[model samples]
Target: MNNIENIRPLISVIMPAYNAENYIEDAINSVLSQSYEEWELIIIDDCSSDKTLKIAEKLSNNDSRLKLIKNSKNIGVSETRNKAINLALGEWIAFLDSDDLWENAKLEKQIAHANKVGASFVFTGSSYINKEGKPFKGVFEVPESVDFNKLKRQNVIPCSSVLVRKECFETIRMERDNMHEDYAAWLRILKSGILAFGVNEPLLVYRLSVSSKSGNKFKTIGMNYRVFRSIEMNPVSSVYFAGVNLVNSLKKYNKILFKNKKIKRLRLTNPL
Candidate 1:
């Protein structure tokens, strides 16, 4: 029989929280309840003025696996995540937003699949949840495997749903500090010729709150426009692909508007 402890690699789960007092407990509990026991939860408090720090400290006091890191000042999410990455001591790094919760088997399933395929980065599907904790019917479809070319067309990898090998970070440093840091980081990784594998299962509950920056569709579109502009400036394959993605992004924005309209109608009729 394999020695479970010896064979299991330590996975570092990093959470960058700012004013997440309402949902941080659920996030912490989700990590603690993971079937993969050999993992550490690192919660970095990004100088939240709310009770987020107090809640994190309370949880850390109860569980030895949970750690609390308070930043001296409020930095953006990118800087907070990079700080957590620098402090991580595990072979693999997993990220969870303060408002997101993982399925109980998320880490176990992802780690197993990563080991099986020898993949450097693994991402899984996620179910969108509203602020009330109700799961939405709408789903995001991510490809099973992503190459450098495919990633250029669209960024299907969800930040909260991704688990990346520590070594991948060594080659492609996460330096993007824009509003769309996740997209920039993924682009950098793909540019370095690293491929990411995806598990089609919805292993995470992605919270969609009005308070979240990503919930602002217009801001996302503007940031994406900037991403394409940066990529177009690159000498290789810019002229063709950048134009393609620009059109695709326009279509995507239209679809999002349509969906929002339907959702609004449903809310009016159903009164929820």
Candidate 2:
């Protein structure tokens, strides 16, 4: 069953860019530095007024593995990603947002784990980074496996940390600009009884921006409720799960903040 071609399956990485000129180069560089070689990166510029397209163009010119496209109009992230998905060539699909960074061996480890466990959907644990690229205090660890029932309450899979089979998107695609598109899509996929495996190591580093909706806990909770609603969840149940999600999310952030405070105190006392 394994041949030279089968030995190294191609992976198409979908990256959607919108005014990400500042970090686009670093994001693309991370993909270029991956230990996995059989991968093609498709970067679609979402009509950014910034220099994102020019920078990606320069990189794509240097490497033939990159496929670059620019939208004629401003399409939202959900649609932008879907457009890139339509052009993907590999059976494997990986996502890396323009602003997020991946560890050098990210794809290598993820694919190795997938083959070992026969996992169709995979996500890695991640740590958060500030806009200036400083590491955060705590890591967001993921369990070995999560089922629909567990994921229904809260989504542990980060969009940039996901690696799924291309065929999985045949039915479901990210939508709903106002809500959490990726979360909704994951819920639908897992609802079909597909179990998602997690790589606990922090292979993905997510960038936290003050302007992003995810930075606002209250707004994200509302978005979580909307995600439940998109899946036809009852209002009462959605509210219940949303509340539970809020508490869990707050606990995680609080833990990170506490660790940060501890480190600051130690620095102050020891004069490090």
Candidate 3:
């Protein structure tokens, strides 16, 4: 795959940039430092009012593998990602938010895991970090594999830690809304009777921005509920799943918030 004839790239990284000047450099640098070389990073700037586009342009200029596109107006993140997806030219489609960072071996290992498990969709466990890039209390654990029923109950998949086949996107693309569109896409893919596997290790560092929707418990809960409803889930099942999601969300933070000496330090690693 590293040969020049395979210049099409093994993975297409989709990054949606929206007022992300504060952390865009770190995000781009993280990708530039990846161990895997066969990847094309397509960064879509959603008409940012800040220096996000400028920084992205500079990074794109430095690396031919990186490309930057701008939207005529300020579309939401979901739409911006879809725009990039449409432009992807790789067998594998990976996602990396403009603010989050990934381990150097994230792509190489995730692709190997996908081939080993024969899965079209794969995600990894993640460690949470604060605005200053310091470790935080929330850590998400992942199972080796999950079926539709298991995923319908709770979203164990992290968007930033996912590497999906491009065909999956053609089958069920992401929703255009801002409210848990990633979760919705996961559920839709699983509903097709496809199993999504987890790497069982934290290959991605999830950044927690208080201003983001996921940072707000109340807003996140509401968005989860709406996502369930959007999938045509019955009211009873939707409420049940929402309750389970709430419990899982609390558990994520509790793992770190109540950390003790017995717990190992949370860091990105290929535990497998």
- On residues 128-193, what C-alpha lDDT tens digit does candidate 2 reach at each position? 777779887788889999899998766788889999999999998999778778888889999988
Q: Please give the lDDT score at residue 253 for candidate 2.
A: 58
Model 1 per-residue lDDT tens digits across residues 169-225: 775555445535676677778778888999988897887643433344444455555
The predictions' CA RMSDs to the true structure, in order, are 5.1, 5.5, 5.0
List per-prediction Cα lDDT, in the order shown: 0.75, 0.84, 0.80
TM per prediction: 0.84, 0.91, 0.88
Error of 3 at 40 (Å): 0.4
* Positional deviation of residue 3's Cα in model 3 after best superposition, in angstroms: 14
TM-score of 2: 0.91
The better-scoring model by lDDT among 1 and 3 is 3
Reference-based TM-score, model 1: 0.84
Per residue, candidate 3 scores C-alpha lDDT tens digits across 1-272 of 54533333479999998898999999999899999888999999998999999999988998999989999998888888888999999999999988899999888788778766778899998877767787765567899998888887678888889999999988677775746888888888888989999998889998764332334555566777877887899887777787788777666556675763333333221111
Candidate 1 displacement at residue 201 in angstroms: 0.5
Task: Indicate which candidate wins on lDDT.
Answer: 2
